[model samples]
Target chain A: MEIVRIIVLALAGLLGGVFGGMGMGGGTILIPLLTIFGGVPQHAAQAVNLVSFVPMAAGAIILHIRNKLIRFKGALYIIIPAALSSAGASLLAGLTEADVLKRAFGGFMILLALYSFWSEFFSQKARKAKLPAHDAPTV
Target chain B: MNGIAKKIILLACGLVIGFINGFFGGGGGLITVPVLERVAGLKTKSAHATAILIILPITVASAVIYIIAGKFDFGYGLPAGLGVIAGGVLGAAALSKLSNKLIRVAFAAIMLAAGIKLLFF
Candidate 1:
C-alpha cells in the first residue's frame, strides 16, 4: 500500500515536471492531482505543489541556462520585483478564505486558457492571412 | 519606451506575475511568456526560457513562505519533487524534437481541462 501511494505521487510529479520543463507551471497539474486523487487538503496540496516546484524548476532552469535560452539581462529586471511580491502575496494567501481563493483561481484559469487558445490559434491564423487582430500581439 | 521605463514596466509585470504565483501555486508562465514577448520584445523561444528563470525565484520565495507558515507537507512533496526532476530532464530533451505549435496546443488543452475541472468539480 505504501509503495502504491509512492508510485502514484511519483507519477504525478513526473507529469508535472514534464510540463514544467516545457515552461508550463507544474503546480497547475500537481495541485489538482494531489487534492483530488491523493486526498490531500486543498491548502496542503498547494503548499506541497509549491515546495516540489522549487527543485523541478531548478532542474529546468539549469537546462535552459545551459542551452543559452535564458535572457539574463531581461530576467534580472523581472526577478527582484517578482520575488518580493511573491513573498507578500503568499503570506496574504495564508490568511484568505480557502474557498474564495479556490473559486477565484478557477475563474482566472478559465479566462487565461481561453485567451491563450485565441492567441495561439485564431490570432496566429489572422496574422498568416495578413489581417489585423485588435488585441492580439504577435509573439 | 526608454530603457529605464522599460525596466520599470518589466518590474511591475514581475510584481503581478509573482503575486499570482504566490496566491496560486502555479500558472505564472501563462502571464510571464506573453509579457516577455509583447512588452519586453523577446522572441518566443527566448520568452519561454526567460519565463522559467523568472519563475524560479518567485516560486522559491513563495515556497519558503508556505513552509514557514506550516503549509508545506514534505511526506508527499519529496517523492514528487524527485519524480519531477526526472521528468524535467526528459521534457527538456523532447523540446528539440517537438514543434512549438504542438507544445502550445498541448498547453492550451491542459489549461482548459484543468480550468473546467476546478470550476465545475
Candidate 2:
C-alpha cells in the first residue's frame, strides 16, 4: 500500500506535468492528488506542488522556447509587478485565514471557464461562417 | 488596446494572478492564460506557453518562501518532482501537435472542475 501511494503521487505529478507543460498551472491538480490520495497534508501538498513546479516549468519552458511559443515581449509588464505582489501575497497568505480568498478565487475560475467555452465555440462558428465552404484547406 | 492601457491591464492582472498564486499555493495559470490572450493579445498557444514563463518567477519566489518556512518535504517532493518534470516535457512537445480548439475546450473543462473543487472541497 505504501508503494501504491508513492506511485500514485508520481502519477499525479505526471498528469500535473502534462497539464503544466501545456501552460496550465499543475498545482490545481497536483495539490488535490497529494492531499486526497497521497495523504499529504494541505500545507505539505501545497509545498510539494510549488516545489515540483520549478523543474516542471523549467522543462516545459525549454520546449516552448524551441517552438517559439513563449511571447517575451512586454512580459516584464506582468512579471515584475506579479513577482512582487506574489511574494508579498505568499507571505500574507502565511499569516492569514485563506477561506475567504479561496472562495473568491473559486468564483473567478467559474467565470473563466464559462468565458473559455463560449468564446471558443462562438469564435469557431464565426470563423467557419466567414470562409466559403468550397475553399480548399489551406495547409 | 493601446500601449498605456495594455500596460495597466497587464500590471493589474499580474497583481491579481500573483495574489491567487500565492494565496492558493498555485493555479495562477488559470488567470494568466486568459489575461495574456485578452489583455496582452497573445495567440492561444502562445498564451499557454507564456503563462508558464510569467508564473515561473512568481513560483520560484513563493517556493523559496515555502522552503524558508520549512514547509517543503524532500521525501514526497522528489518522486513527484521527477514525474512532473518528465510529464511537463511531454506535454510541451505535444502542445504543437494538438489543435487550438481542442486545447481551449480541454482547458475549459479543467477550469470548471477546478472551480467546483476549490469551492466545495
Candidate 3:
C-alpha cells in the first residue's frame, strides 16, 4: 500500500511536471489529482505542490539564467508586488476553509480552461492581425 | 512605452500574479508569461523564462508560509517532487519537437474535466 501510494504520487508529479515543466501550470491538475484521487486534503495538496515546485524549478531556472534567457531589467517591479501579495494571500488561504478553497479553485480552473481553449483556437488568429507571435517555451 | 508606465503595469500585474499564485499555490506562470510578453515587451522565449524568474520568488514565499502554517507533507511531497524533476527533463527535451497546439488542446480537455470533477464531485 505504501509503495502503491508512492507510485501514484510520483505519477501525479510526473504528469504535473510534464505539463508544468513546459509552463502549462502543472499544479492546476496536480492539486486536483491529489484531492480527488489521492484522498489528500486540499490544503496539504496545495502545500505539496508548492514544496515540490521548488526543486523542480530550481535546475530549470538556473539553466534559463545561464542561457541568458531571463531578462533582469525591470523585473523587481513585478517581483516585489507579486511576493508581497502572494504572502498575504497565503495567509488568507491558511485561514480559509478547505472546501471553500477547493470550490474557488474549481471555478478558477474552469475559467482558465475556457480561456486556454480560446487562446489555443482563436487567439493566435486574432493576434496575427496585431503582431507576429514569436512563441517561446518556458517552465 | 514610457518607463514609469511600464513599471506601473508590471507592478499591477505582479500584485495579481502573487495573489493568484499564493492563494492557489500555483498558476502564476500562466499569467506571468503573457504579462511579460504584452506588458513588459519581452519576446516569447524571454517571457517564458522570465515568467519562471518571477514565479520562483513568489512560490518560495508562499511555500515558506505554507510550511510554517503546518502544511508540509513529506510523504506526499517527496516522490512527487522527484517525479516532477525527472519529467521536467523530458518535457524540456520534447518542447522543440512537440506540436504545442495539440498538446495544449488535449491538456485543456483534461483541465476542464478535472475542473468539473472538483466542482461537483
Candidate 4:
C-alpha cells in the first residue's frame, strides 16, 4: 500500500510539473486525486495540497521569469494585498461557517473554469486576427 | 495499519510529489488525500492532516526559490496566501460536516470544463 502511494505521488508530480509549466493550477488535479483516489479527507487534503505548492511553483516561476512571462509590476499590485488578506481570510476561514465556504469554493472553481474558457476563446480570436509582427503597429 | 509505513509513504510521496508540485502544481493535495486514505488506510481527517503537512513544506520551498530569484511577489503571494489560509481553515472545519464526495464531483465537473476550455477555448 505504501509503495502504491509512492507510485501515485511520483505520477502526480510529473503531471503537476507538466501542467504547471502550462500555467494551470495543478492543485485542481492534486486535490481531487488525493481525496478520491488517495482517500484523504477534504480539509487535510487541502492543507497538504498547500504544502506541495512551493517546489512545484518554483520551477515554473523560474522558467516564466527567464522567458519574461512574469509581470512583476502587476504582481506587486496584487500580491501584497492578497497576501495580507489571504492570511486574514485563512483565519476567518477557521471561524466561518463551513457550508458557506464549501459552496463558495465550488462556485469559485466553476467561475474560474468559465473564465478560463472565455479568455481562451478571446485569445484565439485575437490571434487569428493578428497581423505579422512587422506589419502590426507596436502597442 | 502501522506507523512506519504510513510515515514512510507520506515522506516519499511528499518528496517526489512535492517536487512535482514545486515544478508543475498538479499533484499535491489532489493526489495526497486519496493515497493517504486508500493506501495508508487513514481516515479522512488523518488524510487531510497528512496532505496539509505535505503542502506546507512544498509551498514554502517553492516560494523560497522565487524569493531567491527576486521574483517572488509578497504582494500576490501574501494576499493569496491570506485568502488560502483563511479559506483553508474554513475548508478544514467544514470537511467533517460536508460531503467530500459532492465537493469532489463538483470539482471534477469544473475541472472537466477547464480542461475542455484548455483544449478548445
Candidate 5:
C-alpha cells in the first residue's frame, strides 16, 4: 500500500513534469491529480506541487538555455515583480479555505481551457487570414 | 508605447502571473506565455521558453513560503520531484520534434478534462 502510494505520486509528477517542460503549467494537472486521486488535501497538494515544480523547471530551464530559447532580458523584467507577488499570494493561499481554493482553481482551469481551444482553433486561423505576411501577437 | 513603458507593463503583468502561481502552485505559464508573445513581442517558442525562466523564481519563492509555513512535505515531495526532473528531461527533448499546434491541442484537451473533473466530480 505504501509503495503503491509512492508510485502513484511519482507517476503524477512525471505527467506534470512532461507538460511543464513543454512550457505548459504542470500544476494545472498535478494539483488536481494529487487532491482528487492521491488523497492529498488541497493545500498540501498545492504545496507539494509548488515544491516539486522547482526541480521540474530547473531541468527544463537548463535545456531551454542551452538551446538559446530563453529571453533573458524579458525574463529579468518579469522575475522580480513575479517573485514578490508569488510570495505574497502564497501567504494568502495558506490562509484561504481548501474547498474555496479548489473551486476557484477549477473555475480558472475551465476558463483557461476554453480560451486555449479558441485560440488554437478559431483565433489562429482568423489571425493568419488577417495578416498574411506577419504572425499576429497572441494573448 | 515606449520601450521602458512596455517593460514596465510586462513587469506588472508578471506580478499577476506570480500571484496566480503562488495561489495555485502552477499555471503561471498559461498567462506568462501569451502575455510575453503579445506584450513583449516574442516569438511563440521564445515566449514558451522564457516563461519557464520567469516561473522559476516565482516557484522558488512560493516553495520557500510553503516550507516556512510548514505546508511542504519533504518525503512525498522529494520523490515526486525526482520523477518530475526525469520527465522534464524527456519532455524537453521531445519538444524539438513535436509540433506546436499539436501541443496546443493536447494542452487544451488535458486542461478541459482536468477542469471538468475538478469542477463536477
Candidate 6:
C-alpha cells in the first residue's frame, strides 16, 4: 500500500507536470488520486495538491512566457482577487465539512468537464458567443 | 483532436485552470491531466508529472503571497514538499514511455470514478 501510494502520487505529479505544461490544472487529477487511490483524507489531499502545484505552475508559466502568450495585464487583473480569495477560502476550507467539500469539489469538476465537453464538441456555439472585436478609439 | 484543435482545447482548459488556481489554490492538475491525455494525446504519467511541474510556478507565487500574509505552515509544507519533489521526479520519468490513449483513459476514468465516489460513497 505504501509502495502503491508512492507510485500513484508520483504518477500524479508527472501527469500534473505534462498537462500543466499544456495549460491545465493537474490538481483536477491529483486530489482524486490522493483521496481514492492513495487513501488520503480529503483535506490532506487538497493541501498536498496545492503544494505540489507550485512547481508545476512555475514550469508552465515559464513556457507560456517564453512563447509570449502570457499577458501581464490580464494575469494581474486575475491574480490579485484570486490570491486574496484563495487565501481566505483556504482558511474557510479548514473549518468546512470534509465530505461536503468533497461533494462540492466533485460538482465543480462536473461543471468544468461539461464546459470542456461543450467547448470542444460544440465550438460553433462558442464562436458565435465569442466576445466581439473592440478597437480603442484614439483621443 | 487535430494538432491545432488540440492546442486550442488545451489553451481553453488552461484559462479555466488558471482562474481556478488563482482563486482556489489547486485546479490545474485536476483540470489539465485529463485534457492532455484525452484531448492532446499525452501519456498519463507524462501528463501527471507535467501537471506538477507546470503547477509549481503558479502555486509558488501563490505560496509566496500566502507566506507573506502568514498563512503558510512551513512545518507541514516543507516535509510534504520534500516528498513531492521526489515523487515529481519519479513520475516524470515514468511518463516518457507510456502510451497516450492509456493515459487519457486512465485519467478520465479516475476523474469520473472519483467524482462519483465523492458524491455517493
Query: Of 1 and 5, which scores higher on lDDT?
Result: 5
Residue lDDT tens for model 4, A1-139: 7667545544544443333333234566554454445544334444444544654444445544565433232122222332333343444444444344334444444555564455444555764574422211111
Residue-by-residue lDDT tens digits, candidate 3, A55-93: 777877899989988888778899999999999999999
lDDT of each residue in B2-112, candidate 6, tens digit only: 555645555566556555664445764555555444554444445544454444555665555545544444433444455555554555456557774466455555566
Candidates 2 and 4, the one with greater lDDT: 2
Q: Which candidate tops DockQ?
A: 3
TM per prediction: 0.86, 0.80, 0.94, 0.45, 0.90, 0.61
Q: DockQ (Cα-based) per candidate?
A: 0.56, 0.51, 0.63, 0.04, 0.61, 0.14
Identify the CAPRI category of the predicted complex in candidate 1. Answer: medium
C-alpha-based local distance difference test score of model 5:
0.80
Give the DockQ-based CAPRI class for model 4: incorrect
Provide the lDDT at B24 for model 5: 84
Against the true structure, candidate 3 reaches a TM-score of 0.94
Task: Flag regions of model 2 displaced more than 4 Å.
Answer: A97-112, A121-139, B96-118
Off by over 4 Å in 1: A125-139
Give the per-residue lDDT digits (tens) of candidate 1, residues B19-119. Answer: 98888877787799888876777767777777877887888888888889888877788777787788777777786888978886777777677677777
- lDDT per residue as tens, model 5, A1-139: 9888888888877887787766677778888877777777778888888888776677678877898877776567788899999999999999998888888888888999999999987897676775232133222
For candidate 6, what is the DockQ-based docking class?
Answer: incorrect
> Tens digits of per-residue lDDT for model 6 on A27-72?
6766666567666666666666676666645654565466544323
Residue A129 lDDT (model 2)? 63
Q: Kindly list the per-residue Cα lDDT of model 5 for residues B1-121, writing each as its tens digit.
A: 6777888898899889999999987789789988877777777778777888888888899988988988888667876777777777777678789997898788888778877877776
Model 1, span A15-100: residue lDDT tens: 87777766666677777666656666667777877877776667667777898777776677778888898899999989987776
Residue B26 of model 2, lDDT score: 88
Minimal lDDT window, size 10, model 4 chain B:
B75-84
Tell how far residue B103 is off in model 3, in angstroms: 0.9
lDDT of 2 by residue, A1-139 (tens): 8788779888888888887776666677677666656777656667788888877678768878998888788888888888888889778766654465555555766777787788777676774565233211111
Looking at chain B only, the TM-scores across the models are 0.87, 0.78, 0.94, 0.68, 0.87, 0.55
